[model samples]
Structures are given as structure tokens and as C-alpha cells.
Target: MSQPIPNFYAVIPAGGVGSRLWPLSRADAPKFLHDLTGSGHSLLRDTWDRLEPLTGPDRIAVVTGRAHRAAVEEQLPDIADLNVFLESEPRDSAAAIGLAAAILHRREPDVIIGSFAADHVIRGTRVFEFAVRDAVEVAREGYVCTIGIAPSEPAVGFGYIKRGSELIVDGARDASLVERFVEKPDLETAKRYVADRDYLWNAGMFISRADVLLAEIEASNPSLHAGLIALAEAWDDRDLRGPAVDRIWPTLPKIAIDYVVAEPAAERGRLAVVPGHFDWDDVGDFASLAKLNSHGRKNDLAILGENARILSDAASGIVVSHTNRVISLIGVKDIVVVDTPDALLVTTSEHAQRVKGVVDALKLTGRSDVL
Candidate 1:
């Protein structure tokens, strides 16, 4: 018998507050919507565009909070209205995935689903597609296949996946069974992980047959699994998704898909990792963005100083905007100077990670205007 052509579905989780890249990224306008690279398209638009070949406009689903539904829809007009799932309140990724799984399960029982975040940047589309194709084949065999990016550097900010013995499959590159899942490690540990070559960065891109993930969730976090199932069952009974989400989502436990499902599956020898060769970045913070873009030199957009000596070591000119007035800097150094009507941010490229702390402090002091 000829092999069946796989039907693919995608779920994008777009509910993060983007606390790390504040001042630019706020509660009202999240990170995914921001033009971090000054590119016309936002990160969410980039992600959605990348998935066009795999899921098309109709087959993809976006899971976002009610607050951002209009923006999500506006940015992704290609996606149909019915495919958008607006949560009543913001829950973490685990709940988001569960809800997507439940929704897709009701419609297509045998389809392979790809879960992705809206704020990630992925290069090399062809390589990425190949990896997903390989993952689809792996998921067909009942394994929850996660695309694991081979680490190019000792990144301490992301989770790591330990690969086991390689499994040979026909018509696809060899994949490794997941030996274990590790949280973000320290610098020394990250270096060791890179040197061993047995570890890959957890890209947070998941692929599996709908039934497979549901089964794993049932086996691992039965209560959460049950709650998801209940919500799915009653989804059409009433609009139990909006206000009800805030009341019930907090009780769902603050766990990630890795902890609640992937890790346990790895322990049971059912989880696998597909090696990723594509250039990928989660863009978790402002430092990563500046580094990736290399806005480090005086000529770069990092610095905006008055009568300042700007050294051009690849950094661009600084960008400043206040009300209807625009200010441009001619010379600067390894710094970021942003001036808005209500707020101003000035820092060296090295201290961008502290922006989240500033956001937290703002929230604590009720400085919502600047936040």
C-alpha cells in the first residue's frame, strides 16, 4: 500500500507578556508585535509567514489571549477567524498547548500538529522544512518529536536536550531518542554541553500526532489533561473561554510542556529529538537581539549622544522619537539611547538583560505609563 500523505496542523502560542524587552515591549503591545530588528514585519508575522508551506492559511491555529486577538488577527489576515483561539486570560505555554491539542483533536484526529511560539526567529527555511518533514515521519510512529537545534554557542539562557543513541529510519536522517531534558545551565555547564555534542538547544518547537500528545498528557499530568479535555468538551456549549479562563487557568499549575510531558516521556523512552541545522534564535531578551543584529558600534543604532564621538564598529545610528518630534544621532558608541514622549532608556549593549528588572520595578511602583 502507498504511504498516506501527512496532513499537518500548526499551533502558535502568542500570549507572552514580553517582560524582558520592555519599554518597547509592553503589556498592551507584546514582544511578538514589536519590530525588534526595525524590520517592517514583526516577529509574529515572520513566524506565520514561515509556516505557509507547511500548514497554509487555513490549517494553522493561533492561541492568544483575548487582549491581543484583534492584533493577532490584523497581523495575520491570511489566517481564518475560526482558527484563532482567544483565551480569557493569559496562561503559560503548557495550557496553551493543551488547548490547541484539544481543539485540533476534535477536528482532525490523525493529523500531525506543530506547536511554535510567535516570537522566535528562524533562518534557512529549506532546512527548517526538512527538519519538520523528518519530525512528521517520526511522529507517525507515536513518538513526540521535538526539533532540537544544534548549539552554535554556549547559550546559558535556553534549555538543553540530551540526545541518546541514534535511530535509523528510512528516507529520513537519523534521529536521537531523548535521553534527558535539562533546564538552562550555567556558563561552564553550557560549554560542556556544547563540547559533548550529545546536547541540543531546546527550540520549543514540538511535533506529534494529536493522539500521541493527548496520550502522553493523560499518562503524565492527568489532572491538567482532564481539565483540557473538559474545556474542549464544553467549548461549544457556551463561551466558557473568556472570563472563565482567568478563574480556572490559575488552578492549572504553572508547568511547562517539557516538565509536564516531554521530560516524563524521555524517562519512559518515548521522546525523540530531530537534529536542526537551521539558524534559530528565540529572541528571549534585548541583549540577544542587539548581539544578533550587532548594534554594538558607534555607527550602529546603539548610541545617541549629543556632541558624542561615534566609533563605527558595525553599530548603526541611534533612533529617538518624542511626540511629533524626531531626533537623530550622528555619532555614538556601544550604547542604546531611546527617547519617547513619556519615557527614555539609555544603556550600554552589555546591560540589556536588566531591562526586565526595570519593567518589574515599574510594575511594582505602579509606573504603568513608562512600563
Candidate 2:
């Protein structure tokens, strides 16, 4: 029998300090807010638009650090004020999820939450919606459902989900019980995983009832779970959130949901994987931005050179300038050239991943202005 579509809520985690795409992606404006593709809408805006249909504006919640709250608000104005939860401090994904879960549980304990990152590009929206719908139904069945992208290559950048027995439902794509979750693997292991079709990329997208997630937290990390519950209990007392989060967030162990929840659940035979037919990119670094951009250019580029001759026909290169100053580039390839009013980044595509290293070096050298 076809399972009923469950009530859906979206929790977008937008608190990361996107250092890889630095110079362009700053502490004030993270990668999600940047126009990586020159597209007017930012990645976070795109993500919010994609989820609007599945989970209405009211049901959608964005959790971001206090620093990025204004940007998030500016990008997603339709979302109500109360729906945006601001983190007092910069906590990792685990704590971010816990914060959202606590807030949502206070409102609707049975709501099925779809936890996703703010900066991702999904190619097939229709397929994504369908997969999410199916995943929601699975979540309704009391299992934590996570959509797994079929491995396209041996990607060391992502975690892997091992598929077990098939759990087929009418009108839903065939999903498998997750046998185990593997962290970022080395090259050889990654290649082996791709060779074995049983593994899928862990996309960091999750679906589960609020109560179910709380229960899992209680079982897996009792201290964190207790903190979340305490926050939930005092949610109504406006002043409590500030002090409670300040006191608890620093002490909470830094961990990803995959490490804290999905892996353990998979070990206990409680995790499920719904196939994601949509093309997805996490855009973890500038390299990923290049891959997601126009064809031929596998490196992100911002061209601003007068008579700039771009022999390569890839969208990896981006050019941005508010002035009519003609910039030229001759025979330059796989580079990010930004003509900002104050700063500029001229680096090869291969070294784009090392941009964060540059940022760190700058910080160490006390060059806070560039940061």
C-alpha cells in the first residue's frame, strides 16, 4: 500500500564559516549568500525556493549564526521572524540540528523535519521533491530517512552509505535499509566503494520526526540530548534560550549528524536510504563551485581583464566589476579573478581549495583587513 505523505518541516543549517571560497565568501557573507554562478539568487535562496513547495514558508526554519542572521533574513524575507533561529555562537552541524529540533519539538512533536545545508545545487527539482515525499513517508513509519545520492565517482569529499535489504513501497522509489555509514574514505577505499554499487554518497539530507530524533539523541549522546530537552522545556521563557545556549554550546562535543546519529542507527539497523534521482552538489569548496558552473570551465573564474582572452570554454571562470574598466586576460585558465573595491584573488584552479589556507595564514599574520 502507498504510504500517506507526512507533514514536512525544513531546517536549513547556514552557520558555517565558508573559508574555502574566501575573499568572495567572507565572514559576513558566507558561500551560500554569494552569487557563485553570477546568478542573481544565492544558493541559500535557491534552497529555500526548492523547499517552499514541499514545506510551506511557515514550516520552514533557518538556523544560522548571529553574524549571518541579517544576510539570511535578507535572502529569505518571506520566512517569518520567529521561524529564523539564530545561534548565539558558532556550533557545528550537530549542535545546529539539536537547536532546531528543540525549537520544532516545542511547536509540533510529530512534524517530520528535513534537515539540509544552505549551500547545495540540486539539478532535478521534480525528482528531488518526489524523493523527499517518499522519504517523508518513510520517516512517518518511525525510521530516520536520509536521501542518498548514487555514487557517480570515487569521491573522497563525501561520506558513504552502505545499503542493506530493500524496503520497497508503492509509488515510492526503492529504498534500502542502511547497513553502515562510512566517513570520508581514502582514495583506495573510495574507489572500492564506487566499484561496489551498494554504497551511496551521504548527501547530509535527513528526514525524521522530532520525537524520533530526540529519542535517538537521548540514546546516542545523553548529555547533548539532555541539553536539547532542557532548552525545549524553557523555550517559552524568551530569556532562557540566550543563556542556555551560551552555557551548553561550548561544552557540546563537535560532531556531524552522520557520526552521531546515522552511523549508530545504521549499526542498530534503524537507518534507511531513499534514492536521490536529482543531480546534487554540496559545493563544499571553490572546486565544487567550478564543477557546478558552466561547461568546459571546471574552475571558478571571475574575469575582469580588458581583452581577457579565455581560450577555455568552461564556466569555472567568473568576472565581476561594477566599473566600466575593461580588463583583459590572455591565455589564462582555471583561475578566480575578482576585481573587488578593496581585495583581489588571482590563483590557479588547483590551488582554489587552498584558499582557506591563505585565509588562515592571513589571520596568523594579523592581516584582518583581507579576512
Candidate 3:
């Protein structure tokens, strides 16, 4: 219900094959482009919906692969073509987000930029906005800020942010200094993290002044910062932009934003976290996909795609059918069946995380057509 944050721009880094969701998610068409929630909307559109209220459509930008440009533009017709940055090839989060920061900073140095993922599903927009408002306030104070999700369960799939003392910032009462950024841990460590009030799930939501973000990047990784600056300088000139990207993008270091800035900033006491009370899910794997859609019940299951007939007896799993072929299940539990025109994936929810290995094996067999 609050007004949009002034001068706050949002950048969505929409890259990732989501190989764990193999067959259903491919290199050309990733999961972000799919309506995995069965809500009749792609995750990218949902993300735009969540951020549009905070920054408006004009202030939002998206960075994705060149191959998905048409699809991204089709889904987000409101987004201006200039706001969409296409990578010649993959360059990881550091380059994607850093390039965004560099260009936005070039346009408006005082701009507060927030980098969010495209594939996350979130509920409770009001809480989300409140947390983002707080993060913006923290960002205004010259601190690199991130919105950390309040952990609902002991999730080992996500990295954890340990909160230090509470930070005192106007409009950001719940803000806290980040103690450290911890990587994904074992089950026992994750359980302890859940029990401890100091830890929050790292949802990859970073907010900071565009200039400040670039300064941090310059301090940590000078070569990457230089490349981003070069590309950003040429961003406005249509003729030079393509040549700049083609030449500089491949030469930039391939590193994630976490390693490039978050962890190092946390160590220097420059990183802060605003705990988000909203329901958030990255939908990393099929098990998470089941949870998001509220599927995998003992008697009932989730069926995605139209004109797909399914019959089940004592079955508990999900079925995603792209074809009209009837799928039948008997006495099966936690199974995931994905039927496509070219490929079909049948695995249990228990073995869902290992689905990435399947993609790796397929790659070894030179099965690029299915992938």
C-alpha cells in the first residue's frame, strides 16, 4: 500500500539452465520462462509483478542470455528494449549485476539498485515491500544491504546469513549488521541454524546505491570493475554497445556476486541484512516445485499442462504433461513424471536433487537435442 521507492531501480539476473529440472527446463527455455506454479504465470512475470509496485515498470531492468531475448520481451512487453541487457554468453552474477550497477550509476550516481532473481516465487507482497523499503533505507546509509528470508525450515539448499547486532536506521528498525555469509551446510548445521535466531536464508536480494555497489566491486575486483565500466560507458551508444559487450564480456572474470562483493563486504562490516517475513521460495528442485504448488498429497497430485489425462491409484507425486498422452500411476509415492514432446523424466521426489546428474550424464552421451 506504500508508494514506490524514489530512485530505486531493480535488476533481475535471469540466467541459469535449472538442469535439476531437466527436460522440463532446457537451455533454450529455462524454468524462469515456465509457469512451474501452475498459476498461469511464469516466475519471471511474477517477479516483475512483485517489483513493479516498488520501482515501477520503467525503473526495472532485466539481464538475461541473448537466446531468451524474444521470450523475455514477449512476456514483459511493458519493459523497454533499452532496459533489457543481453549477454553474448554466460558470465555469472558478478558480471550481470555489476554491469547493471555500472550502467545505472553512469545514468544516475545516486540511484539505489536492488538485484533480485527471476525464478523466485513470493507471497505476502506487503511484507516484501516493507523489507525492501528497509533495505533501501539501509542502502542510503552507505551500507551494502540484502533482504534475508526468515527461515521456515532447516533448508540446506540455501546459504545462510548470520545476523549481528540490530542496526539503527530510520524506516528500517529490523535492520541488522551481517556477521558472516555461510555456505550451504550439512543437515545438522542447518538444523542448528534454524534453531538459532541469528541466521536467515540468503535469498540473493542485494540493495545498495549504484555508486556504492560499483565502489565495492572496484575495491574487491578491479579487473571486473574496469570491464563493467567499459561496457557501461558504451551502453548508451547503440553502435558501440554490441562491440563493447562482445569484446569485454568474455574477458571479465566469471564469479558470483556473493564471492565478488557480499562475503568480502560482510567481512569488512559494510554489509547489512533486513529480515524478510514474507513467504519466499526459489523453487530450486522438483521437491521444492511440489512444495510451491502444494502438490504431493497422499491421495491427490499436481497435474500441469492442458489436455493431459492422468489416472492414479494410491499415488503421491507430480505429473507435467506437454502431450495429450494419458499418464497412469499405481501405488507410487513421491514420483516426478515430466512428459514432453522430445523427452520424458521419471524420478521420485526423494531423488529430485540428483536430477542434475542426469543432465550431466546426458551431456556426456552428447544428447544436446533433449537438453
Each model's lDDT: 0.77, 0.77, 0.91
Off by over 4 Å in 2: 1-5, 169-171, 185-192, 296-325
Best by TM-score: 3
lDDT of model 3 at position 199 = 94
Error of 3 at 338 (Å): 0.8
lDDT of 2 at 154: 85
> How does model 1 score by TM-score?
0.88
- In the range 70-135, model 2's lDDT, one tens digit per residue, is 888899999898788877777688778877887788888778888988988787888888889888
Q: What clash count goes with each model?
A: 9, 18, 0
Error of 1 at 272 (Å): 0.5
TM-score of each: 0.88, 0.88, 0.97
lDDT per residue (tens digit) for residues 178-217 in model 3: 9998999999999999999899999999999998899899
Candidate 3 weakest lDDT stretch, 10 residues: 291-300
Query: Which residue runs does candidate 3 get wrong by more than 4 Å?
Result: 295-299
Q: What is the lDDT of residue 152 in candidate 1?
A: 87
Which pairs in model 3 have colliding backbones?
Answer: none
Comparing 1 and 2 by TM-score, which wins?
2
